[model samples]
Target: MSLPYTTWKIGEVEHKLRLTTRQAVAVEEKLGVNLLKVFMPRQDEDFPLPPLKVMLVVIHGALQKFEHGVTLDDVYDMHDDYVDAGGDQTSLLTDVIIPLFENSGFMPRQKETTDDQATLTTVK
Candidate 1:
């Protein structure tokens, strides 16, 4: 018999998205990867948490990386500026932001510019 497909869920719906184990692992190692960990946020979780918050955090990380190549780890090692960027900025970067960047086919590119317009090209 063919092996049944395994599935993953985001929010309520079962997503049809596909990722190889290597792809998933690359994304998982980054900040905010859920790995289906109990510590990770669930859509139906209690107050002061949700996936949207994580997405915002990661997007802000994108902005952070845009503004300055602030490795999310650096944010943890040092404080002051990143700490004050906002609660939204901090929690999400380590939870959801980096994962999205990887899972969304953005894993292998760096944002760049030419003619004063932004662009991304695959690194390999």
Candidate 2:
């Protein structure tokens, strides 16, 4: 069966970045963390967000399908460059990666909570 894919844009071209079931499972096994939870953290979770290295590893794993000829070493180098270039890793995940994953139905839509909604409380 075909795996779902997210869209990643390079320059003017949009590429389909897909993660197979095996790939996803392997990432979780190797990293011992769930990418989705890290990608979208909840206020109630006990653990802190996964480390930056872990997140990069997950990103490299997910990009394997579309980024042929690119080794993990290369991805790591690029990741460093990305950070050095004032790129925020969280922004990459939220702005670039999450949108792609959402488009492919790999992740559900995250509800946007506003200040008013967050402030709602019970007085009883």
Candidate 3:
């Protein structure tokens, strides 16, 4: 099976972002909050987008797995490069960040049912 990862391009470099269990724990420690909780807001509060630092931390965490010795500063620079290349923060969040978590299995995936399975009749 293919490994779970999200591809992010900054300038000429393509980064594979994957959050393994260890990386996820490290990210949570750095953020001082549960990784999942970062995306979840209090029931009484409106859902707020994560701060830039949180995004960078997550990106760095995912990147460090494959790109050894990579630093958070490198991630910041990558973000700048991405923006300079016409990638906006909104698109980055929607396209990269969200997909990263989804691909990492932190978020529930949509179950795909084939036509044969979809046509199954229930027995009483």
lDDT leader: 3
Worst 10 residues of 3 by lDDT: 115-124
How far in Å is the alpha carbon of 112 misplaced in model 2?
A: 14
6-123 per-residue lDDT for model 2 (tens digits): 6544444454566667767877788776656665556886645556777666667777777766667866776666667666766666665666556445677566776777677432
Which regions in candidate 2 have their CA more than 4 angstroms from the true location? 1-4, 7-16, 39-49, 109-124
Candidate order by decreasing TM-score: 3, 2, 1
Worst 10 residues of 1 by lDDT: 1-10
In model 3, what lDDT does residue 25 have? 90
For model 3, residues 20-87, the per-residue Cα lDDT tens digits are 88999999888899887777767777955778889889999999778868899988989999999999
List model 1 lDDT by residue over 65-123, tens digit each: 22345454543433333345443433544434444444544454344366435333434
The residue-level lDDT of candidate 3 at 104 comes to 86
Q: Which stretches of candidate 3 lie over 4 Å from their true place?
A: 1-3, 42-47, 111-124
Candidate 2 lDDT score at position 49: 55
lDDT (C-alpha, whole model) for all candidates = 0.40, 0.64, 0.84
Which residues of candidate 1, in runs, are more than 4 Å off?
1-44, 47-73, 78-80, 87-124
Q: How close to the true structure is residue 100 of candidate 2, measured as C-alpha lDDT? A: 54
- Candidate achieving higher lDDT, 1 or 2: 2
